[model samples]
Target: MSKKSFTLSKIATLCAVALSTSAFAEQAKDKDIERVSVYGQHHKNYITEQADSASKLGITIKETPQSISVVSRALMDDFSLDDINAVLESTPGVTVEQIETDRTYFKARGFDITNFQVDGLGIPQDGGDVHGTLDTSIYDRIEIVRGANGIMTGAGTPAATVNMVLKKPTYTTQASASASVGSWNKNRLEVDVSGALTDNHAMRAVVTKQRSDSYLDRYATDLTLGYIAYEGQLTDSTKVSVNYIRQSKDADSPLWGALPLFYDDGTATDFDVSTSTAADWSYWNNDNEHIFVELEQSLGTSWFIRARYAHMTNEQDSELFYVYGTPSAETGLGLTGYASEYDYKDQQNLYDLYATGDFSLFGQTHNLVFGVSSADMNYQDSSLYDYTTGNGFPAMPPLEDFEGNAPIPTLEDAYNGSKVEADQKSAYASARFKITEPLAILAGGRYTEWDSEGLSYGNSKVNSSEEFIPYIGAVYDFAENYTVYASYTETFAPQSEQDQTGMALDPITGESKELGIKAQLLDGQLFATFAIFDALQDGIALPDTALSTPDNTVYYAAEGINSDGYELELSGRLTDDLSASFSYSHVDIEAGDDANEGKLVRDYTPEDQVKVALNYQVPVIEGLSFGANYRWQAKTSRVQSNGTIPTVTTQGAYGLLDLVATYQVTERISATFNVNNVTDEKYLHSLYWAQGYYGAPRHYAFSINWQL
Candidate 1:
């Protein structure tokens, strides 16, 4: 809102990148830091010292060749990030799209982000972004790798892999609780406790409840979440752990779609930001449950083995309403009503077994990993109904003098008996070889077998065998604290639908080449990466109805898809009193075919995007902190025209600013105050055919925490 906000003198605002790393190096000289394990590592405002998602082995940020971002627990607590969607919004180069209030999609680098993992185990996410509502209270941190990950993910794209690291039980006793109040009558209460149960046993538990009314009239939500984890050492070399989580949500008067952008008369509909497009009877409900277990054992000398398994279940039910078709220009008399009901259930099982150790090769120590993994997903029978003119004929209500009251009609058994099941199994291996003191090479591959068979209106089946994916990379450190690396990886995506003749199409294939420079400055307190990537995907699937099979599938493969992009990012504690994260990304994408060559791959993806966040602690006042966040994206639009509901719209460039202030009232008591959308700028959050969503206006929240 003001130019002065962006103005800054060289010393006060700029990150002191030139400041000495000598202090951190000095501290390292006197202490031995534990290796970063996926199990347990904690830091408030610091970057991850070591991570495994990049190469499936513990390595520092600079050792890996790709772009990665980590959002730590301290950052989440400072900003009150309670869900996965909030985490994604803060991560650079990632975008969240809301199809409606209940469904969301995540996008990155011109592709849909389809791979999600928790604690290094890969689980199948429900199609169409059903997992977007996952709660993040049980996680210690989130890791994002911005490139192809054929070594870990048996199938899927190279867009990115998001890993959620759960907080494990600690040997020392710890506990905390918080109460929060925010704009729109939102209230939240949360508690977490963890400690030792016995000499070699530990337990942890967490519970949270939140209720809130939205900015729109008659829209409100209620949620309850719970988690428990137990870990124990059975013997000198054996350990085991188990964890569980559950979430339940209920909402009132949630809209099935965004507000209409144009009236029937080819004129834009002017609605206030607080306008409601929902009926009083519309509702959405979701329930989720997850169970996970792990076992680890040490074999005599230099080898260890581990096994992990997880089961997840998600259930949803909804009754939604929307107004469709054209309306009268004079009195807004003509309009049609669209309403639907659905009951859906989804379940998944994931298992992985792996071993890590060192072996002598050519008079040098080398690392190797061998593992097998499998995943199965089942979508149980679903029920659905479309009620248009029965028991509520004239369901097509007039829009003029509209009343929010719409009769909740009974739904018929129009359920098509929907069902789907998919299975995948793979064996993978990788090794890191030390060529010399300053250079190392990495190589790996996986062979996968997958099958998908289901009944969707009719029976359908597809299967693939011997899908081989490969990964290769090399890193060379020519100078201290800096490393240059290059990597190449490939992925395969099996096509699910069959052709008209009941034959499955070939699996889509993708490859990526990336070169980057990574550096850990300020004695590893800072992680920075500058990288450029080129991705090419062939066999893009396009439907062919002419060859319809007995099951009536119009599935066919397209030619190619290509995207090239560059990313620059910095994350970690810049200094003892200052911590910040900043990122910038730019890209261009197009299809391989001449017909669609020059156009962007995805219409709404921004050509330029930037995200910056800073946290500053006052040197004079202990336990007091101040933070600010800013986000910007270039203009984007959607084009739509239909004889029934014709319209055209565009959203211009927009920026947002949010601020936070925290004060430690006492040794055990602290409070945080946040003001989001500080500028109160009006902008479009998302746009789709026939409808569009408006971004939230300024909002504020206050939270106080107590611990013992």
Candidate 2:
């Protein structure tokens, strides 16, 4: 069937389900089932008690047949992790590729993570690059589910899924404020206020604001965030919640692209950590707004139905400067520059409905959940550029003398542009059945109708018409504290990238298999897991260096790729006053089932990585605590050819250490000091592209906070 036909049919099905909810509720009155509350813990801890990101069924992380990781509020506070990039860097088996000052990419298991969510609602990423900043001030915790999550996200890569859980309003009033001073003239101030607005505590709100400067030359950031929610009992058996979120970012002197890593002599170039390619006039601004509504009604005494709606919009505007071309080691004369203007905006509307309950089947109690969701998005972008011929960009000085003083380029001419519309509709159902007292099985599948009508770089985008992805998993409790499990799932990703002929590449398809064991130790205060995963994908897009288009866009397509890896993680309170987290990850990626079989792939990502975090309350001091975070990675290298002569830039194995100390000055006041990159190690920020930039040097931050 055609994509339009399938979409129409799916819409009809969803409509039928929506209309039949009343009838189903009536029928549920006669059924004998157990009532279950799908709620998680309310307090902060080093480990999460329950998470639904992997299944949306509200199950314990230990019982779920997948590898799960959590960055808890306590951990974030201990490390002073106020940004998404910093949070991901401390996550296990995850890589943060900061290719430029303003753009970043996240990867897990050697694949880019394109799927993300707020709470349990999916929000597809705009592209591989993350533009602007993602602050963590509004989030309560972050849940990461490793491997394919096709059951929750219908279409995406086999990488992990990141779910940011928002901070809910409190029934009681709470307020906090902090001021920070850091290295390189960096200073920041933040304020958070949350409380109930009504006598019954039905209406609540949370508001936060932050402003900060950066370590890089001419860089600064400002942020404002707000959230309001209303939750009240409409009737004895029904409830409703309405929420709104707003966030904005204004940044100055953010680089659009990275600096050249090599010289014309096939040798690596050296630059200070403070070096930047940003022009004094460059700036990036972003805004995001969201509104969500949910209604839940109880059916009889056991079943409950939920319906949700969300609308979100994001906007970005920027004027950026990029420096390219390898300079001469002797004369520093080969470098050139370009200035560009970008304006883009997108909006999405999503709807979801589901029901959950426990029913008796085959003389045993079982859990069932089913849902339908629809998402629609529309977006458009425009780009303009300015460059020079015999010299650097119009106002750019020589490479050696560059200091971000160039004049802003005129952006009157439209060089490239795109407008696109995308829609996805999915129906999914999953159930957990008790085969025995110690064994349970999960089975489910999702049917998706995906459609895209758009033009990018003057070429039509292509996507799959329809797909049905299956999911299955099993868990067996061999002991009171240990359980072994396995899971299998598949995923599909549509490609917007073009081939040599400017035609969109075929969609990528992949499947993942994972086997793991989970254990609870130290009287269940600590959680440990070990897992092995294997995944294979076809039609992955790789840069085709042998070909290029008139627009300077590189073509790409790799037939087959395979990845296998193992990870071990342990997290929680080692003692009453000591909390810690540790992880070790190793993965190998290679070409598969093609002429390039056995060739290594994604060498830019390290094959081995280790991370450790610890926080300890001082036994001798009444109000003092100490914490540390350390990360180490194996050597990573990338090969770039300088006119047929291959040159390799290698960042040797390295480790970074960060220390934190916090002291409670009074009942309502505290002070914190943080030191990062204690050894001041110098290294490349990332090798995702041929060009690269330097990472930050040693930095320190001190903050004073007061709470009520």
Tens-digit per-residue lDDT, 515-625, candidate 2: 999988887777789999998778777667668646556556677778899999988778767888899999999775442432433678899999999888888999899
Off by over 4 Å in 2: 1-44, 198-201, 387-392, 395-398, 462-464, 496-505, 541-557, 593-601
lDDT of 1 at 656: 85
How do the predictions measure up, each by TM-score? Answer: 0.89, 0.92
Top model by TM-score, which number?
2
Candidate 1 C-alpha error for residue 231, in Å? 1.0
After aligning candidate 2 to the native by TM-score, how far in Å is the CA of 201 from where it should be?
A: 4.6
lDDT top scorer:
2
Q: 1-708 in candidate 1: lDDT tens per residue? A: 222232213221221222122132232233332235331122255345455777665566566777788887777888777888778888888877766667777767766677888888874353426432767888988888887888888887767888898889999999999999999999999999999999999999999899999886678899999999999999988999999999998888876776666666677666677666677888889898889999988654555568889998888887777766655556555655666676778888998877665555565566667677888888865545555546332344444344567766666646666688888777678877879988988888877777777776564655554588988988899888788999999978777666655677788788988899987677766767888998877776565657765645586677777778898888777777788888898877777554142243455777788988888989999989899888888877665564766556667888888899999999999999999899998876665334766777999999999989
Could you tell me the TM-score of candidate 1?
0.89
